[model samples]
Target chain A: MALGEVFLIPTVLQDDETALESLPINIINTVRNCQVIFTENERTTRRHLKKMDRNIVIDNFQWFTIGKIEDSILDTFSQQLQLGKNVAIVSEAGCPGIADPGQFLIAEAQKINAKIHPLVGPSSILLALMASGMNGQNFHFMGYLPVDTTERKNAIRKIESMSINDNCTFIFIETPYRNVPLVKDIISNTKPSTRLCIAANITAASENIRTKSIQDWKKEDLNYLHKQPTIFLLDGGRQYAPKSHY
Target chain B: MALGEVFLIPTVLQDDETALESLPINIINTVRNCQVIFTENERTTRRHLKKMDRNIVIDNFQWFTIGKIEDSILDTFSQQLQLGKNVAIVSEAGCPGIADPGQFLIAEAQKINAKIHPLVGPSSILLALMASGMNGQNFHFMGYLPVDTTERKNAIRKIESMSINDNCTFIFIETPYRNVPLVKDIISNTKPSTRLCIAANITAASENIRTKSIQDWKKEDLNYLHKQPTIFLLDGGRQYAPKSHY
Candidate 1:
């Protein structure tokens, strides 16, 4: 029997119906076709599934919570594929296998040669980069910084320097509550001429994406980002460089 | 008056109705609201606009072709924004401002403080990374490798070393016709254990995405990639290293 396909479904970044506008219509069909689901958070996934299609019987599918992708879960996942049971993987928010633990299961599926389809949806990283007006051709997604203050500062400096040297944009995220601290560290550590983009509440009614040099950013009141879901982008290349040096 | 909002519209990777399934339903509304359009290719954008909504009168909106974001285009874009006329920017394919010249115009819009809304759509780079099952938390998009044979080989080696050292996934693209040649270079230059993903014709009926070690890739026939839009990803990190070694 042919191995069952794996579908990577992306969830809304915000918990509002309006946030669902970022997802394509076909995702509903794919989700309906899957008999098994591996989700980051079962509760949120259930709610999201219900939002996608109210008629979907949540209890009819076998659900697996993806915490660490342990050996037992892999075994069960592989077994389901062997039995030709289509499976879907959903993240807590945004696209799976990106800045999330879903990649482990995806890697396993690739090893088993299962067909994997990644559906389009809201991705803060991608959305931020597209609106930043920075170098998108060459960019790096660094996920998050260290929780330790000192280590995080070091990371910011390192990424800023890397961006300047490579003419590449560096993207990173921080805990919603720590957004202000992260921005502070960024402002204090980076050069005055370095360009920074703060994209907050993407896809929501309060969405704001602004790019400015570090010196210019110092004049703004950033208290609005205190607890907002935000993605920060740093571009250290010379101002208005037609193309990236690399 | 408030500065005009700029919409970053993403087009289908493949020119098929099925490919349109990846786009969100709301994009049609945003496209309709815009009174001015700056597109990479006018003919294709006209066809795409008609496809999005048959009732859309193409000549109703003022269209500007974006070859290079020169002074003339920037002047027109800024003038329209100053007039509070909403504008949309469309790429030839995929998301604008990504691996495309749309960023230049976006950068100009940023300077003018225009609200930029980046709509969700098909992006080969993101889709490839998600399906590749590589280290998505930390990945670098290098755009394209050097076209020169010797420089391209050197650049591949450099990126391979960078990936190994940083445990970061490196993504790059090539002209469709040169896909095989770039793969050949990657195979010959990288270590046998390096993981590579070849994603072609993404979001289309003939889509193919596969990930394998360099050694395993050597055994497959890759001639099918000729003239097929493709993205290549390389991860030199040790096999299945749980998290990227930043």
Candidate 2:
């Protein structure tokens, strides 16, 4: 039998109605056609699927909650594929296999020569970079920062230096509650002239994305971003002159 | 007057009916509301906007073809924003400010503190990475490789080494015509076990995305990739065991 195809589906970054607008209409068809689903959070995935289509019978398909890529999970996944069952992997938010545990299943699927389809959707990382006005030609997405203060500060310094030397944009995210501390570390460790972009609550009514130099950012009250999902972008090179009169 | 908002609009990666399905419905409202448009190619942008909504009066908006970021263009862009006239930037394909010159305008927008909105749309780079089954937690997007053969080979080797050392997937694109030669160089310069993914004609009926080891890829003919838009991903570390029987 031919190997079953694997679909990498994307979900909304925010829980609001506007957040769902970011998803493509065709995602509904793909979701309905799948026989098995591997998701980061089963409850949230089921809710999102229902929101996408009211007619979908949630219990008709098999579901697996992805905690860790255990051997038993891979065994079931591979066996399903061999049985010619179309499988889908959904992340809590954004695209699968990106800063999520879905890549392990995708890697296994690739080994078995299963066709993989990645549907388009909202990605906070990609959206942040596009709006940052930084050099998009070369960029690095570092999943998260070190938890320790000193190590994170050192990481910030290294990232700033790399940006300066390579003319590349460095993108990193932090856990919601740690957003403020990370911003503080970024401001203190980097040069005053270096550019930093803070994108919070993306794809939602409260979305705020702004780019400013570290010196300028120091004057603002960033308490608003304390617990909001945020993406930080740093660019130490390619400074622009202040706006000139026409 | 309040600074006008700048919208970064994404266009279809492939010129096909199914490709348009990837775009969000909200984009239509944003496009219709804009008073000015900065696009990579005015002709293609007009055609795309027309396709998005046939009822749109294309000539109502002031159009600017972005050839280069000239001082004159920035002057006009700033003036419009200062006047509180919302403007939009559209690329020939995919998201603006990514592998395109839209960043220059965005940089100016940031300098002046204009609100920038990046709408959700198809992005080949993000899509290719999602399906490559490579490490996406940390990755570097190096826009394009060197055009010179020897330099290109050296570049490929460096990319592979970086992937192995950093455990990061490296993504880069080639001009359609150079796809075959770049693949040849990648296969010849990298280790047999190193994995490479070729994603060509993404989002089109002819879409092809596959990941395989260097040795395995060498046995197949790759001429079909010639003259097709393609994304190449290299992952030299993190090899998985061959699928085990249940």
Candidate 3:
């Protein structure tokens, strides 16, 4: 018996076509062939499909809403695969499995020995890291900081310490509305010379990416980041000269 | 005077169009508009550009080879930007500025206040992580481990310890020819129950992504990984039950 294959698809970061264009042509063909679709938000997935190909009949496929992974949900997936139904996991933004509920579906697929395919697309975290001009050799992506003020401060301190000690770049994102406060915390809590890269609006037309010292950032106007999706990066370690003799 | 712009472009992971197709269409247009290009490897960049668009007059554009960073190279970049020439940085594989020499160029651009644009494409590290079904929220990409036998063992131990202590996924790559030995070291050193995800030949037709326990992997033949580009992931931490009381 043939086992059902699971495709890990990627979506655009913003609502524009520029980010969507990054997807390979085969992804659209893959969408056309899938029997069942699992996504965080069905409406956005439909919209993305429509943009990919206006000819795609959105109602022809079975759509499943991926919520918290429960045992029943795992069973449902297994039964579908047992029936040889192809499954595609889509996310609301960027790659499905990263920082989303899609990983639960992937974990189930892995346990059952299903063939998994990961398609490529825009990832805001990687894009931000690529443009940040910071240390990329070693880096940490801390999805989001704690919501509590004290805990968030402590987390920021820990990130700073790690960046300096490991010679690594630390990356973290925040809730859209909390961008300003997070920047403020980062600027105030870290060392004066710590390098900070604030990448906002990602693939959008208003994209802003700049790397500056904490001291320099403190002197700039930050009104541009209001209510925007952003990724923050810090490289606190002192720059090593090209070579040093032992 | 308007400053020159710098574009960070991604290349195909394999010598095929499947990975290249993930790049946005604007990347070709960006290439057409740029007067100068700085690439890690000029031959590969030329081949990629030709593949992106056959009609592109490759001779019309000035090409610069990115060598080790030094004062003269930095001065050349500044001079080009000062002349208001749009520049593009191309990598041999994946996105430039990440695990490539392009980051140094980007850093120089940022220093001169040049506009930087990061286009979207396939990144094997991120793609592997997205498919690993492991913890994506907290992860580290350690470019490569030490080559010495004792140091390599210690590094593997430390990675496992970090995974268990921080609940973070540890990712690293090895030289293509050394993959088999690295796997052996990982299996012999880590706990039997530690989960390891080996993703090899990503974005290629022969791509393989599997997440298995060290014990299970030890039982299987790993001769397939010889001389292949692979991403290794260790999630030694216990899988947290879906719910945990605060």
Candidate 4:
């Protein structure tokens, strides 16, 4: 049981029924059987659960830990799983492998072959790109940027270059406050003609989808402040090649 | 009212109740709220409605022509909408924007502010990318390729170069039988190390999601002669740049 320190569970964005239903019945079943459950924020999960009010046995658990990578917290989940006891891994929202803490636990789960399965659901990132009619086939998902100023700016430059140089849709997330500066960097750094699709407050009422060439942006576009959740989709301006036929 | 013509409605590739419920409401409230609905195959929609056991009001107009565009069908839908009567546009399957008749209507709609609102749902292309864990932020969905050899080879070149030059995922779909040869061209024509992720039988029991470097593919990899639905995801091998700040 390689100290099944952690097990992965998924929480979807919004209260989207589609995303909730997309979870493999097996994973949910497993969670129901688990002895303990760990969430980034147990209080939020408990409140959300109470509202949904489904008859599930998984609700009661010896809940524990600070949300982010607390070393002792990892030990608690890991030791239980390793001992062949079931443990649940929950993100505040969305799929696990995405730009979230679940990745580390997932990698560990993969290394152990601990019966892992990624249940599919509504990814705000994917939803935005699909509707934007930009490149939905090939695009990078470089989770979140580093906290350091230089590294963060460098990551943005790399993304801008990738968008212009190869015509790839470069995607990244910014902490709420960084939204203004990030948008500014994009405006000042990338080619004026680059196509930008910003999906802000996705899956929520404030949900908005705006797309345009960089040069076309007016000051109003920058007014996307005070909004906490946002996903940026940049069109890599590579020339289009005809699709290959038989 | 503008002369409304019959419309082609592809089966949307999702099974979410809220989304389906929201579609008519969204289209009627926002997009052209017209008096009629035309489809390539209303029989299927009727069957779907029966399966869901919902009493949907579908007014019968005329059968839509498949494979060829009918001018008369276009006239009826276009005219009614133009005359300030709202018209509804749908497909027999999936979203209209990807490789379908909807593009023609959508382009026309955009030109006239006939208002196009593409709702979010399960797209085979996006689903494939999501499962592959490859690039999702930037990708080029080059619909279907032209079938001529010289032109197709040229198209492959464009796909290959984009991967190497920009690192965007190149997504393509082929008739079930042609996937093997397409893989051969990608392997022979591009760098041997390019990564390829092909997801066949997506969202179904016989689903196959396989990833292999170009050089690692064996005769076995090309052995599938599946008569199943497929979406091919390929990594054209774009070089990652040295870190830079945006």
Positional deviation of residue B72's Cα in model 2 after best superposition, in angstroms: 0.9
TM, every model: 0.97, 0.96, 0.97, 0.62
**Residue clash pairs of candidate 2:** none
**Candidate 2 lDDT, tens digit per residue, B1-246?**
788999999999999998898888889899888999999899999998899899999999999987766788889999999999999999999999887878888988988989899999998999999998898889999999999999999999999999999888999999999999899999999999999999998888778889999999999999999899999999998764434311
lDDT of model 1 at residue A130? 94
Winner of 1 and 4 under DockQ: 1
Give one digit per residue, the lDDT tens place, for model 4 in B153-175: 88887877877776667788887
Clashing pairs in 1: none
Candidate 4 chain B weakest lDDT stretch, 10 residues: B22-31
Which pairs of residues clash in candidate 3, taking residues 3 or more apart in a chain or in different chains?
Answer: none
Off by over 4 Å in 3: A240-246, B243-246
Score candidate 4 by lDDT. 0.55
lDDT of every predicted structure (CA atoms): 0.90, 0.90, 0.86, 0.55
Model 2 spans > 4 angstroms off: A240-246, B240-246
Point out where model 4 deviates above 4 Å: A1-10, A15-53, A59-91, A100-120, A133-172, A184-195, A212-216, A219-221, A234-246, B1-50, B60-92, B96-120, B133-172, B184-196, B210-222, B234-246
Question: A143, model 2: CA deviation in Å?
Answer: 0.9
lDDT of 2 by residue, A1-246 (tens): 988899999999999998998888889899888999999999999999999998999998899987766777878888999999999999999999898878878888888889899999999999999999998999999899899999999999999999999999999999999998899999999999999999999999888889999999999999999899999999998754434311
Best by DockQ: 1
Q: Using alpha carbons, what is the TM-score of model 2?
A: 0.96
